[model samples]
Target: MTIFTANPHLLSTLAPFICFIVTVICLLTSIKIMRRYRHKQVFIILICGLGTAAIPQLLNAYAASSLQAVPESLYIISTIAGTISFIIINFVFMKMYAIGIRIRIAPILLLSLGAAIAIAASFLLAPYEIGGTKALGFPVLDFYMFILIITMLVVTRHIEMPAAYFISLCVMFSYQIALMLHQYVFEHSQPWLGALVMALPVLYYFLLFYLLLEWIMERLLTTYQSAILDGLTGLYVRRHFQKKLAEMIARKPAAVIFCDIDNFKSLNDTKGHHAADQALQQVASILRDEVAPHGIAGRYGGEELLGAIEIDKVKPQTIAERIRARVEQETIVTVSVGFCTTKESAELASLVKLADEAMYYSKSTGKNKVTSYRSIPAAYKNKA
Candidate 1:
């Protein structure tokens, strides 16, 4: 037999532990969706958590069962891996799964001190004897402390999450804590303890399962929003605006207002493209804030914004005036606005034409002015 396989019972001893480790890895693999993703940090931390639990168990088993037969190098590597994993879990918990930590010396010092103590206790301390069986017992204590510290962190965070997330966490935490209690306090080294200990990894797996679904849904929503939103102005793109405008036309006495930046192309030429883009973004912001309460607003191509508001709540002229005034005040740019209100049913194309004609009237008559569709000159209407 080969040196590594000399012990016939190694498979018997390692199979269950290896299976639990596999379960942990499977949790990670299942959640790994390349296109639809969220919280990469959490995925990494979970891998750390798995190693923190699994590596120590595997090494401790080898050390206790075949201390004389196993190479000393294997034992040393286990000690290093386990000690680092233990320290990482504590530090990670304190940071609350965030990339950055607050400026607090106490948490750092506390982590350093705990890591030092755990490393020393695991490597230097004597094995615990129970029922005439010799065992390196430091890992059990270290992991129990891990559960306690993370639980404290959870409480401090007030478990603030969606109802689904909160319930999943609570259920998993309850199962894990109960299993730890059973394994450590009531029956150490029991065959049943080994089976039940698998529960901890499984419970955590379920928590991650729920979290994976949540992450996917959030990603899909974010992607959908991006698809519909204009990149520069944070307004709905033309496609989405067309849909919303059609709906508004069918649903109510809707008004459409079109506003165009005065001499926008000249501004782009004089002030540069960067300044022009900034001006457009600023104008879109004013339109969004002013028009959102009553209706929807979106970019209708460059240097122009469109609002679809139900005229009963507020007139399109009033909404257009607010937007024009705000743009003049908040930005260096001014806009010419033309609006049309309809108390009766009107086709979307016709409404847009009326609003556009009025806006062109303002563009031709005066640079910064508000014009209504009804006020457009007869010649302008005929031309339109």
Candidate 2:
């Protein structure tokens, strides 16, 4: 509070150093994200924009701290660089919103045009002299801010933007309007006003950092889901399902149910791969829905689905019969279903093999019926 109430000149002098630190932090974070994520275009653009934005702040900090007089040409160059960097940062926001279109040449052209305009504006606009202090002003930046707000509003109408990003944009827009009012309408440089102006950028950068982290987390989650789930049936892949089954058997009494589509090869040969794939998906969907409450289901292999359930929760034979009946009634093909309870064999491999043997017996005997390992005769089991 005291700092805000102190001499406006002192606060204004410290603003550059504070802004420089924040920009460098954001630039470093973008670089780290790029290195870890294989150099995404958004991270690269953020790094470039932040790096450019940092230059003017560094120059201003140096000029303010130095005892010797700084050259007017250096000040002009800093002003032009700051204006151009602002344009680049605005373009970054636009790029984020319109991700479907790859904007390669427009940004480069806009940067070049912005540089020319900024250079001309710096010379054409006279310096603002207030309270015996001279400050360089760029009226063009205010106009640019107005255009940016309008463009962003239009872009947001067509594209969905994250809440954090929209909030950051609103903060920047409000700050720009307030800063314009302070500089042009009221024409005052009060200590509180200067401090308010300097503090808003830090908040904006923090929001930007959070938005990037959210995006990275979403990508990681999507990749993880893709790795564990089957692409065609949306069931767990064989390896992950086995791992889950092992854990389940270790905890309590469980049963393994194996299902194989009947006449899958014949269907594939006559009806084509597309039709066969549809049948597999339909059967998998039925297994997934029926078994999800009591256990887990997976794609064991081509046209083969596997499930594991705790015996305490529900009967495995009932679930298997439901799956078989559903496939027979709803899909273009039938399934031979078999199940082995933990009472028979608790070991994961043995349980799966026994269930598969029972399924094979069903396939050989009938084709669309369900078989429990306990129901098989001792002679047949001995032969198996």
Candidate 3:
């Protein structure tokens, strides 16, 4: 056993420097998770957990070395904080991604009580000797290891995890278990590298940071998409659709179809608003089916839908007829559609005006009809 008895310069600087780096990384990641997801209490708990383990690592670094070990008191206290924080993180992850997992207080109470009892045992069982030298906190370390490995297994097994996460976690926990077991065997039997092995759990801590970052990115993307998309109809809102339409107009020759439900107000009055909403959704579904592969469909207003497409690729009349046939066939309602394709008119407002005029012409003559702006009479054009 080659152990440096004098001031071990390399060991001293390398160990603490590594722990410091881990602390900073954990703190920075937690802060980002905190600021972006401030509304979530899990982030607060996560930050606290990360800091709890990190702050104690500086003390732990000193505890490591060739000749001396960290005080048992400092060691056990740090372990307790870290163990509890890990449990909280486990709980929150279960709550977040584990569908149908029980969140009742029983599991938490059981785990906390178990950890507390084990930690206290470390305190009560102290002042012992390992290999004829004064030692402490080893049993507590061992027990805590048991609790963590088993708990992580139970957590990931009972709940569903994404395949990548599950595999990554499995690899991480495997390394933790392997390192701890090596420490347990060699702590009493031989001169060990206390500083390096003891600090390896921080490597696992970094993996936790990775998981949190991935979750936050997924959450932000979902939120942004929800903002632009309508929850009820799964269509783009007017503002986003308008923005996209302008972009499309700039790219190629574009056309638009504007449609409104026929006798929508009467249907709402007679069949109740529920049926009216179903009718609108049905019309949206129909429009959505045809307006794709170079097109967009959106809710222009209540009971109104607008479909936009590239005139060079897709004929405007094709989408309008598909929607008309589908709505009349599938639902108890019908639509009045007006399609406008103008190479000369480039502005969105002008296109909408021409479409809306033709749509109103259908409503005036009779319901359940499709009209093109080119088909409207000169007198009606003057009125329009």
| Candidate 3 clashes between residue pairs 3 or more apart in a chain or in different chains | none
lDDT for each residue of candidate 2 in 216-265, tens digit (9 for 90 to 100): 67777889989999999999999999999999999999999999999999
In Å, residue 193's CA in model 2 sits off its true spot by 5.2
lDDT value, candidate 2, whole model: 0.76
Error of 1 at 311 (Å): 1.2
**Of candidates 3 and 2, the better by TM-score:** 2
lDDT of 1 by residue, 240-269 (tens): 988999998888888888899998999999
RMSD of each: 8.9, 4.2, 4.8
Query: Per-residue lDDT tens digits of candidate 3, residues 296-382?
Result: 999888988899999886788877888888899999999999988767378988987788888888878896888988889999899
Quote model 2's TM-score.
Answer: 0.82
Error of 3 at 249 (Å): 1.1
Name the 10 consecutive residues with the lowest summed lDDT in model 3: 1-10
lDDT of 3: 0.70
Using lDDT, give the best candidate's number.
Answer: 2
Which residues of candidate 2, in runs, are more than 4 Å off? 1-22, 36-42, 56-83, 86-99, 115-119, 128-132, 189-196
Task: List candidate 1 stretches off by more than 4 Å.
Answer: 1-32, 35-126, 130-136, 139-211, 343-345
Q: Which regions of candidate 3 deviate over 4 angstroms?
A: 1-23, 32-41, 59-68, 95-110, 123-137, 144-176, 185-203, 270-275
